[model samples]
Target: MGLDAFAAACCAIPVLASLLAVRFAYVLCRSGLPPTRPRAAGLRCLIVLGSGGHTAEMMNIITELQKDRFTPRYYVAALTDSMSLQKAQVYEKSLIQGEGEKIIKNAQFMQIYRSREVGQSYITSIATTLLAVLHALWLIIRIRPQVIFCNGPGTCIPLCASAFLLKVLGLGWSSIFYIESIARVKKLSLSGLLLYKLRISDQFFVQWTQLQQKYPRAQYAGRLM
Candidate 1:
């Protein structure tokens, strides 16, 4: 290539990169802002379920949600968490009994790889976490949910991160709502802390006023459980 052409290409490369970076930053900042769009019906919702009490608390919240507005609901749990999945299924069955067959048809269940198993060493967890993140990216891309609801759960980090990536790229706008586990009175759980620190969740809620004071961004909802 000619010297002038080579020089121009090199200059354009940095300019293009800088422009892309600016665009990315702008998108990320805008994503955290309160959405101005008017509420619409039939919005897609994705709910992440954790084990035991986390699942129970989330189930209670789900029961209170306007089912008609959040159509085509998707529930995701860790692959090894059979109990959580079962609980979700039972909850859906109850909805069907109370509502109708339409409720069952609108709901879907999915399982994702756990980022780290209980008591697993951090050294080994790195690999598992990467795998989990990749799986989460695929799931997020496929689902492209408008609303994501997750309580404190390690499984949620990867999914939320993937959703945030989509938002930054301007590919999707997933409004993430995270609620800290009710058991955490004075502090946030690891998942909640990460989501808060990274500004990934559009809305973060805590059950205790003290916790909300400590984490200024967290909204105190007064014992959601």
Candidate 2:
């Protein structure tokens, strides 16, 4: 009787895992649909900012966002990226000036550790990457944002992965939108490639028509910058 129960449990494990995987895949497939209207409280949004040009382009895109709908915005950047945070703060300040105290109360900024620094040894990067992912998971759980917006940034990889995990576990449903950098005319950035190949992003956009042709899943939005 004990041997039979053990065998049954072993068989059940794989079956349960397979069902979870199927459910997760269905969720991913359905993610592309337009989200329903938010509650009267509004939707929480998480925006991941990269360094330099990446930040500039993202700011441009976000500037057009309806501040009232995507309320309680959370801006995330790399721990080492003070400049990007500063830029985001500046943008928030502009919002405050235009929209008043409500905008000030609705904005939040956060920083996450980078997975792998440039020139870091790959051996060491593995450990650092794991740490980053763990930190990202904690942040995602804490925020539980309804929408996640990011462009070409390595910093976003961990956050998006954490959000996807939450979705699979039936913990949260953070819609992830990945926009390729405007500079990537011929190919997707490494970060973009990973998200694209993994199908982790609910919506993927590219500026170049060539990239759209090459990646049918990516929508061509023209030069956003």
Candidate 3:
């Protein structure tokens, strides 16, 4: 109410936030996943695809997952990124042809607004991120994916954040796996940094062993591409 009281309250905000963050980190780290069990067919997955290099790396990760394991895969990217969507479709088609009818049932695509356009202003980027969050939240609610996968890119941030919020709210139990870009051998990209610091990702994968050592929790699972 008074100046001194108000100042003290404001000062306490950061401390409260820090304490909350520590608790969150503890819960996330201690909440290790349940033991692996034999799963029947049809595990839903949601994969976020960024453009160009990001898309390629994500595709490689999906390929390594083995088409038989994850079923009903949903690929999401920027609405304008037709190239990435098309590429995903083609890959899905190949799986359908190679694996027969099963793979066809699992492949789907959804698009969200781009978090930032080329050379967009910070204000515009923020607006776009809000829109992306709304879209991501809607998709997560409707699809209720078992696991969500993404690699480093600005576009993936909103979706990953949305997934984290869902987890916090106990609305979804979707595991989030974030793989740092292969290009980021020494340090994480901005997006990767945010996800890691926020402790939103259940598993973080790095291509290089050095990064794994740097971020001890991150798994070094070889090169994505």
Candidate 4:
């Protein structure tokens, strides 16, 4: 076979495998994802961790979480870029006016990062990841919240890691990753890969049907805007 033909054959196998896995995952999620509603009553705190548009959605969920019987204690924000922080600030008044959900912004060097592109972004990302882990560990130690909710930024890496550790030690609260999109081009996203690897979030609420096929573990939540 010619060189081009050989390359096509090699690529074809992985593509076919990916397709099969997608099909298998679709069948799995068609049954539905694991139950995510807080099993216990009186959830002391619900940390809404996201900055941009995702943060808006998180805020909505935070509202949902607060509506429950418990009466929330804090709304910890580890914001990403400045824009996200601005978006978060807009909700500051709403957060305070209610049952005293403290809107504390704890953005360490690692929790917030920006660069033009990939390349060394990975190296900085690692630093960012380490800092986030330390921040998470420290927060979990200090706040001792019943749950750490995530609408990922690079900041989430450490928090998720620390929360997972806490759970193992039998001292941690619940950690959740609010998966906004199921079919994002993974090869193009550092955060997405991190979410997949950490895998700590209790449930992944997928917003698309095609995505459910790609991520078999994800629970299809239907379409998102």
Which candidate number has the best lDDT?
2
Task: Report the Cα lDDT for candidate 2.
Answer: 0.91
- Cα lDDT tens digits for candidate 2, 32-63: 88767647777899999998899999999999
- Winning model by TM-score: 2
User: Which candidate would rank higher by TM-score, 1 or 2?
Assistant: 2
- TM-scores for all candidates: the values are 0.89, 0.92, 0.82, 0.59
- Whole-model lDDT, model 4: 0.54
C-alpha lDDT score of every prediction, in listed order: 0.89, 0.91, 0.82, 0.54
Which model is ahead, 2 or 3, in terms of lDDT?
2
Ranking according to lDDT, highest score first? 2, 1, 3, 4
Candidates arranged by TM-score, highest first: 2, 1, 3, 4
Model 2 TM? 0.92
Q: In candidate 3, what are the lDDT values of residues 8-52, reduced to their tens digit? A: 999999998887777666548644475267678767898989888
Assess the local accuracy of residue 40 in candidate 4 as a C-alpha lDDT between 0 and 100.
64
The root-mean-square deviation over C-alpha atoms between each candidate and the true structure, in angstroms, is: 2.6, 2.3, 5.3, 12.6
What are the runs in model 2 whose C-alpha is more than 4 Å off? Answer: 1-5, 36-38, 98-103
Q: Candidate 1 on 1-225: residue-level lDDT in tens?
A: 699999999999999888778877776577657668777668789999999899999999999999898878999999999898788778887876556544488889999999999999999999999999999999999999999999998999999999988877668889899988989998899999999998899899999999998999888999776
Global CA lDDT of candidate 3, please? Answer: 0.82
Error of 2 at 142 (Å): 0.7
